[model samples]
Each structure stands twice: as C-alpha cells, then as structure tokens.
Target: MTTISCTYTGDLHCEATHTGSGATLSTDAPLDNEGKGEAFSPTDLLATSLATCMLTIMGITARSRDWSIEGASASVDKLMSSDGPRRIETLRVTLQLPEALDDDQRALLQRVAEQCPVKRSIVPLINAEIHWA
Candidate 1:
C-alpha cells in the first residue's frame, strides 16, 4: 500500500509528502473558504486525482498493448454544492486523446479510463461526467 503523510502547517494550509517518492505538495484552503487560495485546495486535489488516475490507468493499458498515448491529457472542472453541507457536487472531465488511435483503440481506452479506481470510487457520490475529445 502507498502511504502519504500530511502535516497541517497552520492558517488553513497543509503540506503532504509522498512516502514512496519523497515528492511533496502543499495545499491551501480556497478563497471562498477563508484562505489565501494560493495553492490547490483539498477539493481541487480530489478532482485532480480523478483525472490523473484515469490517464495513468489508460496509459498503462496502452503500454501493455504496444500503443502510444504520448500526448493524452485530461482536464477536470470541480463544482461545489451551494446548498446545505459543503461538498463537491460534480466533476466534469474532458479527455483529450491522440488522433493516432483507431476507433476500436479509442473505445477500449475510454472503457479503461471509466473503470479507473478513482472514477469507480467517486461515481455516484460525485457526479463525474466524462467527455472524450
């Protein structure tokens, strides 16, 4: 299992370290949430995680099949709920894949992306709408 250690650095800011790779990232609360909004907030990271996870999984599948997804990219838009408790309402994802892939390859990669662990985990909880381009 992977482990990530996070430390709250005061003033609605935090620093997280990836134990495996020594990679580090900082997080700050959004402006609307009474923070400086200088960095990615927790909810932003959640949205980012979904997009990255899908791309990574799709890349793995493509590599196993001797296909290249060299320029594949994804973008996610996070929308928060305005009523009741604070929570993410929707995560709109746009997958931009290379044009070198055929119809069948594209279809397979789309399926792989949809089944990504992050997507599977957050589906019904958060409305994740994925658009392919």
Candidate 2:
C-alpha cells in the first residue's frame, strides 16, 4: 500500500508528501471557507482524484488491448451542497476521447472509466454524472 503524510501549515493550508516518491503538494481552504483559495482545497482533490483515476485506468486498459488512447482529456466540475455539512453534492465529468477509437473501443473505455477505483469509492449520495464524447 502507498502511504502519504500531511502536515498542517497554518492559515487553513497544509503540505502533503507522497512517502514513496518524495513528491509534495499543498492544499488550502477555499475562499468560501474563510481562507485564501491559493491552492487546491481538500474537496478539489477529491474531484481531481476521480478524473485522474478514470483516465489512468482507461489508459491501462487501452494499452493492454493494443489500442491508442493518446490525447484523451477529462474535466470535472465539483458542486458543493448549499446547506448542512458543506459536502460535495455532485461531480460532473466530461470526457473527450480521441477520434481514433471505434464504437467497441469507446464502449470498453466507458466501462473501464465507470469501474475506476475512485468512482467506486465515492459516496452514493454524491451524483457523478459522466458525459463522454
């Protein structure tokens, strides 16, 4: 299992380090949460994770099938609840795939994207609307 460590850097910001790779990232509270929105907020990371995970898995699947999925891109819009615990309400994802793929390949990649680990891990209450093109 991979391990990541994080340290609070004060002012609603934090620094996280990927233990194995020594790569680091910083996060800050969003402007709506009473802090400077200079970096990715915690919730932003969650949505980012979903998009990245889907693309990575789809790429792996395509490689295994001897297909090219180069230039595939995805965008995610994270929506937060207006009331209560201030949690994510929806993650709308739009994926634009290269035109080189056929219908069967598209279907296969779609299935792979849905089965991505982050997609499965997200709470059911959070609506993940996936649009592909």
Candidate 3:
C-alpha cells in the first residue's frame, strides 16, 4: 500500500505529501465554511477523487484493449446533505466519451469506469450517479 502524509496547518488548512514521490498539495476549507477558499476543500477533493479515479481506470482498460480513449472527459456535481452532518450525500458524474468508440467499446468503458477501485471503496456511503455518452 502507498502512504500519504498530511500536516495540519492553521485556519482549516493542511498540506498533504505523497510519500513515494515527495510531491505535496495544499488544502483549505471551502468558501462557505469561512476559510479563504483559495484551494480545494476536503469535500471538493473527495468529489474530484471519484471523477479522476473513474477516468483513470477507464483509460487503463481502453489501453489494454488497444483502444484509444483520448478526449474522454468527466464532470462531477456533489450534493451536500442538509439535515445531518453536512456530509456529501451524492455525486453525479457525467462522462463524455470519445465519439470514435464502437457501441461495445463504449459499454465496456462505462462498466470499467463505474467499477473502479474508488467507486467500490465509497459504495453504499455516497450515492453515485454515472452518466456516459
């Protein structure tokens, strides 16, 4: 397993370091939560993680099949719950696939995107709506 190290900075901000590559990223609270919102909030990262993971997995699957998945894109919309802990209740993702794919390849890529590791990991907790075109 890979390891990620995080250091909490002040004012709802923090830095995360990827141990393998020594690359780092900064995170801050969202604008609604009172921080500067200059960077990605934790919740925003969570949403982004899902979208990126799906795309990456699909790319790998396409490559393995000798298919080119270039120009494939994904969009994410996160919904926050109101009554409870203000947590993310749903993530709606729309993937615009390259028009060059055949119907079978398109269906295969869609399945791969939805079955990625992060999707499985967050299943039953976050409602994921996946749209492919």
User: Who is ahead in lDDT, 1 or 3?
Assistant: 1
> Quick one: best TM-score, which candidate?
1
Shift in Å, residue 128, candidate 1 = 0.4
Error of 3 at 64 (Å): 0.7
Best-performing candidate as measured by lDDT: 1
Each model's RMSD to truth, in Å?
0.7, 0.9, 1.0
Return the TM-score for each candidate structure: 0.98, 0.96, 0.95
Model 2, which residues run further than 4 Å from truth?
A: none
Between which residue pairs do clashes occur in model 1? none
104-130 per-residue lDDT for model 3 (tens digits): 998888888889888898888999999
Between prediction 1 and prediction 2, the one with superior lDDT is 1
Residue 88's C-alpha lDDT in candidate 3?
89
Q: In model 3, where is the ten-residue run with the lowest total lDDT? A: 78-87
Question: Would you list the clashing residue pairs of candidate 2?
Answer: none
Task: Identify the superior model by TM-score, candidate 2 or candidate 3.
Answer: 2
lDDT of 1 by residue, 76-133 (tens): 9999999989999999999999999999999999999999999889989999999997
* Total clashing pairs for each candidate: 0, 0, 0
Show where candidate 1 strays beyond 4 Å. Answer: none
**Candidate 3: segments with Cα more than 4 A from true spot:** none
